[model samples]
Target: MCVMSRRGRFQRGEGRHLCNLSGPPSGGSASPGSFLPLRGIDLKKGGRVKKPGRKALVSKDPYLRLLVKTYKTLARRTSSAFNRTVLKRLLMPRRFKAPISLSKLIKHMKGRENTTAVVVGTVTGTLLYRDMMMYVSTESRRSSDSAGEDDLRVNEVPKLSVCALRITRTAQARLLKAGGEVLTFDELVARSPTGSKCTLLRGATKAREAEKHFGKAPGTPGSSTKPYVRSKGRKFEKARGRRKSCGFKV
Candidate 1:
């Protein structure tokens, strides 16, 4: 027998019986019924499952791995934001670590002359002008072979000390030749424990030619996006929908 409760549902009662707390009262005890309501614990609410890690790192280069380990230690020990940033960048792929040229470095380091320039990628060589005891002469208008090494100029290019993951052969030579220093990651750690007096520089990311074709439809008005075409010939994409005579403008 079952008894109804005030809610009109039959809840489980004493042994071998069911109780409908909302309905009329029933017999005291009844045979054990096969049907039993599922317990509350059986139903699982929807939720987000915990994952192992935030994101997996994708890198296998031994040198990069070493740098990551070094910076990771520094990041945890000193609690410096610069070290943390460097560690994060070290774990990133090669694309994010773009190579910087010597010319750009020179331009950026103009005002911050004393501070060390740090690049997470390779550094390419650029021409450096320095003041030396070299002779210079201009050819005479009267004679073609009248020029000789005579005058000297004191114009000198400033020396730049930099730290980077990699430096080109020519760049290293030029830096060393100009009384500049090129230090590695480990060396940088030893020099500046907390990355003080350091300026981080990144390559021009949007300077790549491929970025020009990344926005808006190519043929749309006021859109400057470049279209994918084989060549710039007049007959290539200049027909039909592209011209009003053949069809409507696209």
Candidate 2:
């Protein structure tokens, strides 16, 4: 029931016209009255498809660049042995506390810088310590007793702990004031060689608390510095007096 005529074509007593949605198709339909889909949608694919290109990383972000710079600076200034021994210990599982207080850890580490204090020390050859809570532990003093007499030897453990650092509002302003930006959690955590987002963040919090007179509030969701946010029942808030703000150096 279809054929071309003076007024386009007729199909089932309905007048329909041919159309080209794209410029690619070659053959023309016989009826010219196919009306269901309006035609020509498939014709534009080849020519209109976008060519792939290289994706630019977010390295351009000032905060990201600063994170990288800070990492290099600290790594260069700090000892590999110290960083490796202390940072790795802190990063260990079940060794750190969540929502950790920064100022306290820094003060404690600096205060006990000379002593082999284990913020993350354990009796099982692991370390665990919390400055804010005045907590410290280490491999239980290795003790040896000579059966021959009342002679005893005490093996003192090495004070192999990180020196905590604290960054106050003035410090933050100074860092950011000079065209710098605060690090979001991810970036700060990334500073660690392990790429552990959480451990490094907690370590940073502990480190920053080392400085004297250092003070700032915690972080909240929607904060510019709040880096990690998972959708589907998880979201990070960026607000004042929140942990994410002051703990980790961004």
Candidate 3:
């Protein structure tokens, strides 16, 4: 027969065996029909299933795996937060390792001169100023060229000592031409075991093309999110609630 306890728990007593419908009662005998005991759950351990994090490197690259191993050892040995952070970043996936350009790196390194700049991703050769000028118009480029010698300095890549996982050939050439040094992770560790006088930098996370289509639904009022339209032609998504003549716009 089932009996409700003072605590409002259902307790079924069948002969000498007791079954707890909720869980084992405190200081009470073990219930034969308790699911918690069968599932091997300990109430003392906060019984919620824990979500796991990456325990090992997912990359097939032997060098990257070795790097992770080395950092793991470093993190275990050193008390520096820098070593721990580098180890965590090194274990991240490729998409999280966003590439940083020389122009942006130069801008970030300003006022923090002579410090080793570390990036856990690729160092690209794309010039931000030149790209912006080109995107503006051909006339703007001509005007920029005719501006002055001072204006030309914006295009000049500066000499920088950078430590990164990978560096493009174009970027490497530019750095070398400007008397810069590109050091590997091992070299960086050898120089500063505790990561002293080092500047950590990361690429723009929201700069990806896919990020533009992520927020609020398209066509909603005040929504700026891009729609997953097949084409950009006029016959596409431009009708019904999109125009004043189309049965009143949304």
In terms of lDDT, the best-performing candidate is 3
Candidate 3 residue lDDT tens string, 107-156: 89998768999999999987557546544566655777787433432477
All candidates' lDDT scores? 0.73, 0.36, 0.81
What TM-score fits each model?
Answer: 0.65, 0.18, 0.72
Clashes of each: 11, 33, 0
Candidate 3 TM-score over all chains jointly: 0.72
Per-residue lDDT over 1-250 for candidate 2, one digit per residue giving the tens place of the 0 to 100 score: 2334456653332234434333433686544344433422233436566655322223355653453455454556766454444434333343242233333333444544433222332112112243323432322222223233211221222232221223345333332433433343333334444333222224333432233223442243334332334542423443334444645432
State, as a TM-score between 0 and 1, how close model 2 is to the true structure: 0.18
Candidate 1 stretches greater than 4 Å from native:
1-56, 127-156, 240-242, 246-250
Q: What is the lDDT of residue 18 in candidate 2?
A: 37
Worst 10 contiguous positions by lDDT, candidate 2? 149-158
Least lDDT summed over 10 consecutive residues: which range in candidate 1?
148-157
lDDT of 3 at 21: 53
